[model samples]
Target: MTSRDTVTDPLPSGRGAALPDGGGVPASPPIPPRLLTDLIDSAVRDHGERRAIDFLGRRWTYAEIGALVDRAAAGLQAMGVGPDVRFGLCLPNTPYFVILYFAALRCGATIVNFNPLYVEHELRHQIRDSGTTVMAVIDVASIHAKVAAVAEESGLEKIIVCPLADILPTFTSLLYRLFKRSEIARWPADARHMAFGDLTRANPASFKPVAVTPDDVAVLQYTGGTTGVPKGAMLTHANLTANSHQMTLHVGHGAEANDRIMGVLPMFHVFALTTVLNFSVDTAAEMILLPRFELKQFLKTVKRTRPTKLLAVPTMLTALNKAAASQDVHFDDLDFVVSGGAPLPFDVRQEFERVTGARVVEGYGLSETSPILTCNPITGVVKDNSAGPPFPGTTLEIRSLDDPHRIMPQGERGEVCARGPQVMKGYWNKPEETEKVFVDGAIRTGDVGYLDEDGYLFLVDRIKDVIICGGYNVYPRVIEEALYEHPAILEAVVIGVKDDYRGQAPKAFVVLRPGQSASTAEIAEFLKTRLSKIELPREIEIRQSLPKTLIGKLSKKELVAEEAKKAAG
Candidate 1:
């Protein structure tokens, strides 16, 4: 199959307005009902000799990765991981993660992503919640201990330990294992635990792919629940496949086949999973993986690889801008950069583009909508501060917060709702909660945003993140944006805290730029002219750094929890 053969334009022009180029949003043709694993198979067939992944100094060709995937799939089958079985993947962005992820899907098992940093308590909740019996985890000491604890608490039957050195060359693996022996977790010599190397040695390459339909569950992506217990969003094969097509349509051939795409963000994130892993595989692009984001190391890799596309978060961009301000960091080779996970500050975007000469555009998505709903067109006009237009087949409407059924007028701030082929089936095992979010056919994205006349979408803030000060709704994002305008402020997050009179009030946590200093009163004084009294943060706390989610979005939840704990104390 050719590059264009995997997807096509199926919708008519009437679905949306025309673009600046006198064309409607590129419509994705009916995505063929195919398993997510098919992307890897196609990549191997088309670019087998090309390097599929680059990790550390090691490079794995598409053909080599495909063989490993087959071996891992067969090994999983021998271990009883078949269709309908929940296979949990708790590894980070490593070669093991790539191989096992596809291998598990090839076995028709639902992939459940877990943050490797989670403690025992957190692991138990997710393990029990997803009913994952078999899990693949990194063989580091800290993570392994937590997984073992979860296994002891839950009915975790099999644990496949993927060592950091397992995938390295023989000499390097031996050196790494010897030097890093203290960091490696040796799970008690037992039958319940198996090394990834031993598992692959089974080499069941003859195992056949399981037959599955479009509706079959592909992954159970868990969301950071604000209202109640964390629930998994059930994304089907159809949902992910359509999103791959939608993104391709939105970007419009900017991502060429065999282009080097940077994978700095964790693949476990839905945003990175779609954009970095699945999308690159579908397009037969070479993916350069960074186990985690380290500004210095990332720049070094970029200089070496000369990646064409970067799928990054706002925080990474902010860091890059700061680094570039001090000295030259080559980024001119980057064809395009898509920033998601959080809102990209206007200043950061400007500086990044000025230094790197790469077009930086923002996109919006949630785990439930198979992640991507809107992205500024790569080949077309990008409006300032807008997340751009809806993906080809997606229909986005701004609805009244009071009544989700009441659709608001264009350019109105309200709850952003979306309906499309990419939307998930529902929240896993939570029919009632799913009913609450899905009104009619649209998924009520708890976010507050407006759509322009030309169909570009601009986000304001999340409804849950809104601060109520003296009976008035205050959006923290508005205050945060003002704080970002301050030259000294490097990172800022606003959260609602308990108040004696107002019931709740907004408080800002800020991180200053290196060698920069600012007093809380000075910040408040600066913002006084920019914001109304009630909208301004009542309290500002200066810190060395602010908390971040696994994907690096500012974690207002952690700040809120910290405030709550302080109040309790």
Candidate 2:
């Protein structure tokens, strides 16, 4: 598909405008909109000198950012990255990440965003599964080891290593490397891959934008599979662009183009991708980047940046509130705290507002929906625990799990399904899995929720065993597989347990091998480097045996039920 296919004239002012067809204007399309690339181009042309991203201590203007993105696109073209090529981006929330992301899109390549915390095995699996030919990674030692392990095996021909402080001056780079060695050790080595800086500096700051259609796959966000493997959700340009516009409209007058946004969430996650990165770019707002969320650093950044908008999960909000209470940090500048990636407990929301003086607005979506389906209206009266109302032009219906075709009436909880342009095209190369979720024309959100008389959504439970901690989705199967890696662990089952802060935290029930022994702390420490903090279990329970289904398969549902009963008693 060509750029001509994606770019359409703005629609007339109306409730919902029709989207253009694949090549020309359609009779009636869902919300007519510009492509994501067009939005960036306009930002660059209008806000060329405006601050686009602030990282560490350096700031990048829109002109500088656009030039860098173009150079990166040129470099990728030089490396044979073009239409349909899947390029892996493994950097954190930094200017390099934004550059590479838009650059790949500009080249019409599908971006495969990889979690930087993935172990070598997980990284290898994603690289192989996505069939990525090029990977742009942070320049850290651990990442180097993982990339080296799978570079040749996965058919990855090129690796681009970006320094954590490359945009900073020479002295700052030296100090950053010396002071941040422990955390930065995960970056790849200098010799293993081309440096992002050198490549961009050498390349010309001009490249032809590839013709892309709205239906062209822009990003392939991978999610944990029910079959014990991960698959990429094919989110097309139309999917992402439409979702961003939907969110922008839903936010209403709360956020303006001049408002600065705190981007503490990882760009790899779809929540941050749409709300923080894409939304900020579309509005021509400055994004204050935090590579990772550390309480002290996070507080310091917020204090320094004084951002007007904040997007985060319940766990991050809980931690920030605790830190604010102790440190006396001022959050009067924050306009709204947008929460997602998990359910927001009522108490947590209340406490956060009491402590920070900011209202928390909860939203809901999955990776397959370009991540934003329902959100709290910026000006509406909010229900205590609802995820607000559906965004403009989006339709939500809860259907019985057994009969997906039958939509349940309001106030009755069932599987939440959504229909909109933001819905993904399909799962990459997984036709059966794609068919199972995409029924009729709507996407089945595997989450169970219901709508009230006021059209507000209240989430009851997740149909899938996915644990969300600190706004990141943590699959129980992934954690259980990690537990099995320990020689002492004979069998293990992981489940999400209620937490005062994080909504739900992972808890592992383990059975030791005959005569083998290991403590909870030991297992926790063992998995620390292998998984991100959100994926780690809060507690580990040594079990003589785990309850199983009638077929004898280890059942997490039974374990959750027993835990619930124990807690009630």
> How many pairs collide in each candidate, listed in order?
3, 14
lDDT of 1 by residue, 80-158 (tens): 9998789989988988988999999989899999878655655788888989989999998988888888696788999
Native RMSD of candidate 2 (Å)? 4.9
Question: Which run of 10 residues does model 1 get worst, by summed lDDT?
Answer: 9-18
Please state the error at residue 134 of candidate 2 in Å.
0.7
Over 387-440, each residue of candidate 2 has an lDDT whose tens digit, in order, gives 888777667777878888677776888888776667777788988897787655
Report the error of model 1 at residue 110, Å: 0.4
Please tell me which predicted candidate would have the highest TM-score against the true structure: 2
lDDT of 2 at 9: 27
